[model samples]
Structure formats: C-alpha cells, structure tokens
Target: MSQTIAVLDFGSQYTQVIARRIRECNIYSRIFPYSVTAAELRKANVSGIILSGGPSSVLTKGSPRPDKKIFQLGVPVLGICYGLQLMGKLLGGDVAKSDRREYGRGRLTIKKKGRLLKGLPKSIKVWNSHGDKVTALPEGFEPIAGTENSDYAVIEDATRNFYGLQFHPEVVHSERGDDIIKNFLVGVCKCKQDWKMSNYVDQAIQDIRDQVGDSRVILGLSGGVDSSVAAALIHRAIGDQLTCVFVDNGLLRLRERDRVEQVFRDHFHVDLRVAKSGKRFLKALKGVTDPERKRKIIGKIFVDVFEDTVKKIGDVDFLAQGTLYPDVIESVAIDGNPAALIKSHHNVGGLPKRMKLKLLEPFRELFKDEVRALGKELGLPDEMIWRHPFPGPGLGVRVMGEIKKSYLDTLREADAILLEEMKRTGYYSKVWQAFCVFLPVQTVGVMGDERTYDYVIALRVVESVDAMTADWAHIPHDILQIISNRIINEVKGVNRVVLDISSKPPSTIEWE
Candidate 1:
C-alpha cells in the first residue's frame, strides 16, 4: 500500500482543502475523524498526520482531540489553528483566549527558518482565523515564526518532528501556502511523490471490476463533466456491463443531448439509451415560478423518466454516479466536530434504496480536477472532460422564476451564443464558469424599425480555483460586446444584455 497523509478533521471547513493541497503535491491524503486512534494510524501506515482547524477552542471542556499515543507513532505531525492550541494544551503549554482575535491576513515574521518554514523570506503574509493562541510553548518546542498579535504563530518541536501553525496555509489567501505544505509533507514527512492520476485510473478499473463481477450497472448520464466522465470510466471498466440512461428534460444547453449521443454512443461504442422526456418535464414545470418548486418538479420528472427507462432495460444490480469528493465533503458531519453541512446532494436521490440497487460511486473520494484527469486517461474528448459544472435542474435554474417552453428555448439559444462567443475569444477556458440567465421580466426595446418587448439575458462569468468562492471575471469589453450583440441579433430573444459583477459571498454563480 502507498503511504498516506492522514488529516484528522476537527470540523474545519477547509479540511478538504488541506487534503486537496496535499494531493496537488502528488501525495495521497485522506481525512479521518479526529478521534481516530493511534493504532488505526499505524495500521494505515501514515507518513504524516495533519490536525485540521475547528471552530471550538481547546480550552473548552468537550473539545475534540486525538489519541495521546499519536505522539509516540514517530511520524511527522502538523497542527493548524485550533489544532495548534490543542497541541499546546496537550503538550504542557499555555493556551488562552486571545485579547484580539486574528481572523484575517497577518504578516508572519520568521524567527528561525525551520523545516516547516523552510524558505528564504524573513516576512510573509498568511491567513489567520483563530480565536485562541498558544501563549507559552511546551518543554521541547520553540517559536519558529510569530505574527504581531500572536507570539507563537508557528511552533515546532524539532526533537519530536512536530509542528503547528496558528494561520491557515491550506487556503489560497496565504502566500506560498502550497510551498509551506510541501515543506511539511516532503521535507519533514519524507513522503515520496508517487500519487498520480494514472495510478488512480488503473486502481479504479480493477476495483470496479472486483466490486461488479457479473453485475449490470446503470448510470444516469448527465452530459455534464462529472456524469459523463463517470459513465466513460465505468464503461471502460465493465464494457458491455454498463448501460447509460440520458434523460432530456427539455432544460439543457443547446445540442447537449446530441453531444452526449455522439460522444458516448458514436465515439466510445457504449450502450447508450436516450430518453426524450422534454415534454414531460416542461409540462410538469408549467407555471412553476418558485425555485425550490421548480427543482422538485424537475427532480421528480427525472426519477420517473429514469425508472421507466431502467424498467425497460431490465433489472440492474448497481446504479453508478459521478459523485466527486466535494459532494461527499460537503455532507460530512464527522463525530460531532462542528463541521457544517454546506450542501446536501443525492446524485440520484434515494433511487438506490427505492429501486433496490447498490450504489456505485467510483469517484466519490476524487475531486473535480482529478475526475477530469481520470476522464482523460479513459480517452474522453477534451470538450467533455473540461466542460463546466451544470446544476442538476439544468436550464431550469438558468431561466429564473417562471418555467415556460418559450423561456427555456430562448435561454438555451442565448446561452449557446454566449458560450460560442466565449470560446471564440478564448475566454471559455480562462474562466471557471460562464453562462447566461434568462430574466423572467421582459424589457421594451426597439428592433430594426419597430418597438418590441422581449426577455432580457444576464451574463454570469466568474474566476475561481474552487467553486466554494468566486469572483466576477473581467472579460474584455470587446468580447462582452460581441457576446451581447450575437445574443440579440442571432437568438430570437431579448434585445438587452447585462453583466453580473457580483462576487460569490454577496451573490451566487447561478441566478436561481
């Protein structure tokens, strides 16, 4: 087995982020409950252990902590934020509530360039989000770096191969954050960078084969990257044992169904079944203005279509989905550690239990980029692999408020035009996600020689390393003008186009 870096979750929201950072360094990392015993860590042969930051303070009576025996395991250990305070308290140091809580950027002044702070700069900025600080070091520990508010910003026990950081280096806001993590993972832990996408691909195939010996697997194929990639990988593994059911809910992007058919059916020669249920979905969504209701209607229609399709194809043993790690991480409530559930996702939504089929999520532990890499290894086309994320409700959410066939048709055309212009100007790949929204209210405008009233289109484009947070993309005025002009002239929709310049916290990427 390959050596692993075990990140013990203390309910920090960035726990998954830390795991991703480790994976980006070509090192395998897995998140475990904070209560994971030392024997379990030894059994897994972890090269290093990372204690994630949490909301609770170590001074609290019922705060989470790891096994005391972990210190004796002899592997390199790094604690972050709340983890740092816990480390101090457990190791015979003083940890108290800070007079001034450091919740944002702080300048780190390096006192000693230790292995954890193994760089040339004397000062660097780091993101700090902590309410408590380590006031005094343990017997064998020394302060390697400090910020203005906290004297022990970075502490290390060189004799024990243990380190702690008051700031969060897992986040992108911290300068040279990746380098800091690399130092701990590579230098201190001595982890060989053997983790790669190719290795995952080979292992996933064998695991799939082993799990699904003679069982038939049915996957609900959404043309989006995740499901498409999942379908491709499952097909590559089981060959004729997989059947992909593509449901056309009449709310997808322009030519999305055709693209799925061409890629999975024509190119890969997999068993593809296309369910043309556009009318069913549009009928069910008629006059539904509430976003939640629209989602419910779409989801119900999808399940109906999927069940009907699967019934005709006969019984399948397993239902496969392209559930990535982000989805799983969002819903992880690890042992009362106060990790919030960012969102709830059931890729197929209770279908496995209702239909009595085993759930097969091969990419459940993999991230989005990793899935794309896996897709590439499975020989999927670039367009499919690099496609932006699409909401489960599809264009249903893009057409804000009311659900009408005319609205969907207009939205699809406008969105297609927007994407075409984005790709033409080489802006599609530059931005994380770019799509157009169809406003429910119509605006009056003069077209050619006549006055007309039509719907308005809103363009939403953002730049982000992860969809957790996003900033509006500053596409050049020329490209925006081109996209706006094309939507108005080519698509039989609104004459007016507007840009959304709001960031993620204040506004979401999708209008609905």
Candidate 2:
C-alpha cells in the first residue's frame, strides 16, 4: 500500500523473479515496460528502480531502452545484464562485444567497497548471462567488482546512487543474490518491510468492487488454486454478481469435476453451472497429435464452448480468469521479443474473434504461492489450497502424441494410482507436481514367464518452491518401488512404469 519499487521489464524472462525476490524481503515491487517514463514512475511514488535483464544487445537497432530522464529521478537505480549495457551506452560509458560470452555461474571479486555491495564478501559467485560487457565507466563512476574475464563487472556512482551489474543477482543460482536485493531495497531505498499477502485481501476486494461496480462477471473455474482463489475474491467483492462455469472436457483427473462442483456450488453459494461437453472435446481432439496444434485446438474449442455458456447466462459485463503472474509473463512477449514463448496461456491465447465483454484477471500480478496464501485468507480448505497445479489443456498435453479415449483412460487410471501411492507414502505434499504421462509406445515385459506387451506410463515428480524452476524429487527408493509396482499391476493398460529424473532447464515438468 505504501511506496513500492519499480522493476522495468525489457523482455527478460527473469523479470518476475526479481519482483518475487523483492516481495520475499517484505518490500513491495511492481513491473513495467521499458517504455515507462520517469514522470509515470514518479507519479506512482516509486521508492527505488530496478532495470531487469533482457535477451537483447544495446547495439542492436530497435532494442528496448528506458527513458533518459530516469537517471535524474533522485532514486537508486540498479542495472542488470543488458540493463548494464544500456546504462553504459546512454551514460557515456563504453560497452563492447566480448570475444568470449560469459554465461551460467561465475565468481565476482569486489574491486571497491561500495554501498551496494557493502556487506558482501570480497568474492562471491554470481549468475552471468551476457554476450557484451562494460569496457569502461562513465564520469563519476567507479568499478566495484569484477569476474575473471569481465573487468568492469560491477560499476557504481555513490553520489547519485546508480549501480550496475553484469551478472543477474535476482536468480537463486547467484550466491548472495537475496542480500544484494535487500541492501538495495532496504538500505538504499528506505522501504519498510511491511508488505504481506494477508494485507492484499482488503485492498484487492475494494479494487474489484470499484472496477466491477454493478456489472455481471463470469469466471471459468478449473478447480486449480489460482482460479478458485480468484473466484473467491471476486465473489466476496460482488456477492451475487459473479457466476461460474466449470467445464468437464473428459480430460481431468479422477473425481475432479464432482469435487470442484461441490466445493464451489454447494459450499461457497456461488451461482455455478456445469457444461457437459466432454464428448465434443474428445471428438475435436480425436486425431490431433502435435503439441502446439493440440493446444491451439483446445484453446479455440474452449473459447467457443465458453462463449456459448456465457450466451445462456445472459447479459455479462466481464470475463474473469484465474491467471497468475507467470502466465502473464510467458504468454505475451515483453516488447515483442523472441525466445519468450515458454507456453501459451489458455485464457489469453485462447480468445477467438471480437467480444463485447471486457476481460478481468485479478490474480495476474500474484505468484502461485501468493494466490494460495490469499485462498487461505479467504477461508479455503487446506486440502484445496495445497493441491498441485493442473494445466489448462488438462490431460491432453500429458497424453503424448496422438489423442484417443483409450489413452486418456489409461493415463487417468495410472495417474490415480500414482497419486494414491504418493499420498499413502506421505510425499504428495512434498512434491510440486506428480502425474502420469501416457507414452504412446509399448514395451515387452515378463509376467510369470509369459510375454506381455502393453502401453508404458512415465511418472513425473518434481520438487520446487515455484513451478518456474524445479528439480526431480528424490523420493525414498522403497516408496517409489511401491508406486511403480501399483501403477503397473493395478492399471490394466499400463504394463511398464518409468520415472522421469530430469530437472526444469533440460526437461519441463510436463512430458509434452
């Protein structure tokens, strides 16, 4: 509610990570485009400014650049990666293409004791991802730190509180990254450590009421934490004005439709409607095999069905979705940059044709954990709030390659067995995602000296603080053995089970 830091997004994938880190320190932060001017930032009462790293070169034509007047805003400015090069170019410092690009984890040695790096060690490892380096500094600037190949890795102007780092200090892979952000946020900007997820409830409720006014809102509740929490918030703000539509596409996990409907319709007193269109969805996806094609088909189909449902609901003013911050950052490219496509958001990219109703997404700025915290603040059950996330396409993406009713049936059964065993072994809550992917292939197996050939199921389980990055969960060997045995023996179609041991960078949590 008070003064918040402004993080300028120049098409960086890790821009949200920087904002998340600042919030972790109990300091409020918001993200903006690189085109935001100093007048706009000042109007928002920004206490400090952070320039996020981007996949761009300062020398490239049409690359994103911040307003020139930002340096004169009388606030602390920290530049990272491409942000450093941009500052070096505009402030009369020299930057050049490095013969050897520095990437991944590296070390930074302090060259001078500056206020930004005040309490840090003489040398610390940091994450670097840049092809260009600052060769010289501007007037009144001093070199603060350096890595082996990077001579001017860190530069600072103590007088005006301007600092730049060639490495990304917002990532967890960077050693002492949190300390660096804390020093800049608290030490330099004088921000109060008062931001809390619980405090967002009242503010968000007031905002929703002001925005929605007397208009009717329709939300597509997928029973996921983000959507359920978002629906609860909007319902609280406008009691009888919000109607929910839960669509069962015949691709969800076991008993998902019944449980979600009971929770929202019966318990929360929400005006909920169920659309029985599983047969249509399955027929549309009968022969589709490509991943992106499958997603587009689902997106287009969902919008069509959702629009039809809204037509029956009569006179709706807005379409509400439970979209989180990650969905926002990944779906749309920041300033139209390439390599920004992680995946397409169903609600965002799924839109078809022109519509009269406005779109509303209250949870677009919050992360997954923050949404859960808000759900708790709204008195949601612990089991519902702590459930693992499900994708928009449901089991369509999980069933690799072709789409078939038999494949869906096998995947659903194996997935249920996997979940049951994980819950029994007490590892369900410890893992971020646990599911079964239908590998459309067969393997030969021995069952009491008899040869058996059937479909193979790959189980994916990972541990992560957030879904942005994750590592394969290391469950106890005995528990895993039990899971594999149950999934293979109990599930009729699945004759073999394999566990995915890859991390986030190399392999995404979902097999597709």
RMSD of each: 3.0, 1.8
Query: What's the true lDDT of residue 409 in model 2?
Result: 91
Q: Model 1 — TM-score against the truth?
A: 0.89
Top model number, TM-score:
2
lDDT by residue (tens digit), candidate 2, 60-164: 888888999999999999998988888888999888899899989889999786667878889999999999988888888888889987988888888988889
Candidate 1 overall Cα lDDT vs. reference?
0.85
What are the clashing pairs of model 1? Answer: none
Q: Which candidate is the best by lDDT?
A: 2
lDDT at position 24, candidate 2: 91
After superposition, which runs of candidate 2 have C-alpha atoms over 4 Å from their true positions? 332-339, 448-450
Instruction: List TM-score per model, in order.
Output: 0.89, 0.96
> Global CA lDDT of candidate 2, please?
0.86
